[model samples]
Target: MTSLVVPPSTLGSSFFSWFASSSSNNSLNPPKIFRKTPSNAVALYPISLKSSNRPSFDRFPRTKIWATLGEKDPNGAAPLQVVEESSSSIVDEEVEKSVKVLKDAAKTRRVAAEEVLSALSVLEKAKLDPSKFFNTLGGTSSPGRTWMLIFTAEKKLEKGRYFPLTAIQRFDAAGKRIENGVFLGPIGSLTFEGRMSWKNRILAFIFERIRIKFGPLEPLEISLGKKDEREPSSKDPFFIWFYVDEELAVARGRSGGTAFWCRCRRVNT
Candidate 1:
């Protein structure tokens, strides 16, 4: 992330000032940062996660509102409860987390672009939907912004069930990348329960929403692309099998030219 960081002294304004201004305006915005596209930059895709154990989430963890049983209600299943926690406090915490991470990812620290991608994969794998709640990294097209659109769609539960996902593309002043989106099918908004983070990202989100919830060591894997020679045309972009190191996992096995199980790695989950 050394490449992502910028020195405060070099800016015409204060570090926190830039953050407050930029983050306040750009949260949840699309890829709008002006970037220098690396000449060697190729097709970068997220490593799809496939695990035998399905992931689950809790939408509301703190506020508890159970239906008080009365003679008037007699049913095998009680209705879902709606607990209204102070939304502002949760929003504040999320904004703070977004600011902190944005600062780190946008810094000249050694976390670098790859680290940004890694952190993003974690969120993607867990099926977190940032759009449902706060989008602190929002922005519009900038003067010379370069962007990448990642369209991910697939069924998660039943054959007809699919997760709607969205992620923004981010490039620091130096063209390093940082961005993430989520699986959006839940009702209501998302809440930031906080996180477990290290110096340069590499965090596990502890959040809740109307549909699902996930947390640390979420049984995920990161893939290092493995090339497949077969292609409709040699000139066409060939497919790569992704594997997460130090873990045994399979996403969408190498059928139809997309393989998930051949190789995998531990995501510190």
Candidate 2:
């Protein structure tokens, strides 16, 4: 036999060709390779081969995998999850704050209503005292004029006090001091007579029957009584009537063809 000697170049080329052919065939039926080196024992490695045009390893280690998956920066997928949680927490806090504000406002309104009721109670109590009562009368017109008739109860009693129990005062249309006097005890009745002039007689007629309301106390109904022909008057006749409360507490005195028509009430302090 001829002496067989393997050249280094031929051995290297043959190893490469065998590797390629084995790789191509191994694509359909993948092979398990076992290599024994001088220092290491048997090392088993699995090599998956694809088409020759493709990369040697079917799937290679991906570069910067975590970065590509958005996991390394503040704006990454994990950071987005944290942001969503934080945003939800903030919205919940705001909702709770708004609820608290509404509750506080409702409580304040209730307290205010209670305070108003307390004030009204005090005012109502003050109105019950007869001694604290005072009456004021006034009238107004264009180029307006106003008159005030005040009546205050006396603190002490004396001899002359019983004789003239009440007092009376008169004011002119100009609101200037015209007359002031006292009603004698034997006078029996008092009367205030006047005429209301208007460009339209119909207005005066309607106004003559108007009613004055006093908050839950009573209503004073004004009506025409009799026409006094003797007194020279304008087209609007002298409308006469007695003022009285619904409860009839301060009623007009009816005796000796005389009637007391003025009505009075206690004022709330």
Candidate 3:
């Protein structure tokens, strides 16, 4: 066996040859070296790799960073969220004020209604009679005057002295003069006895009927008696008459008769 000694250069060359062949056969395809692309895919051109042409990554603007974090400008400090909050606060205040105003108005209306009810109750309790308080007088004959009178009275400060009675007049359907005077007094007591006539017996009839219904006259009275020419004795003649003790004061006459009636009562408190 001859001694085979390896030289350093020859051994090194042999190891490098073996290493180069093994690497060529076993290594992957150099990891597919890829070129760097621009951050924005829509950019017209890729960014340059030169240090001078590339973006200054080390000197990034602080403003850009703050903008990404949703920073507002110092001069125009109001953000959308802050503005919305302020607007919402104002709207809430207005709504609250409107509600308060409506509540106050409702309270006032309720108080007014209560006062009206109280006044009406007082009027109903008084039991005032319309027939006794109002005096009827004459009116125009051509239009056939007729009136329905309403009287309202209120108690005044002095005892036995009452406020003036309020009066309203409603005319009849036939345009007849139903009421002549609307002042306070008995039929014959007024200075002017309105244009009363025997022809319009319906007027007198209505007055007597209303008095009987509302006045406290006892037994009632009929003054004007039968005017039917065919049956001079028939009691159904057309004329206003006072009824007292269920008897007629004026017997059957062709014309003028007392058409007044009254019921006496003590003044109420």
The TM-scores, one per candidate, come to 0.20, 0.16, 0.14
lDDT of 2 by residue, 1-269 (tens): 10011111111100101111111231111121211111111111111111121111112223332232435455545532433222333333333332232223222222233332332222222222221111112223221221111111111111100011222222222231122222111212122323332221111211123233332434354553545533223333221111111111110111101111111111121
Q: Tell me each candidate's RMSD, in Å, in order.
A: 22.3, 55.1, 56.1
Evaluate candidate 3 by giving its C-alpha RMSD to the native, one decimal: 56.1
**Once model 2 is optimally superposed onto the true structure by TM-score, how far is the C-alpha of residue 118 displaced, in angstroms?**
46
Give candidate 1 regions above 4 Å deviation.
1-62, 65-95, 111-145, 148-269
| Residue 148 miss distance in model 3 (angstroms) | 14
What is the per-residue lDDT of model 3 for residues 1-269, given as tens digits with 9 covering 90 to 100? 10011111111100101011111242111121111111211111221212221111112222221221255555465343232122333333333332232223222222232332233233222222222111222223333222211111122201111111211122222333222222221211011111122332232222211111112223233432323323111132223321111100111111221111111111111
Q: Any idea how many clashes model 3 has?
A: 23
The worst-scoring run of ten residues by lDDT in candidate 1 lies at 11-20
Candidate 1 lDDT tens digits, 208-238: 1111223222223332232332312212221
Candidate 3, TM-score vs. the true structure? 0.14
User: Local distance difference test, per candidate?
Assistant: 0.22, 0.21, 0.21
Task: Give candidate 3 regions above 4 Å deviation.
Answer: 1-111, 133-169, 172-269
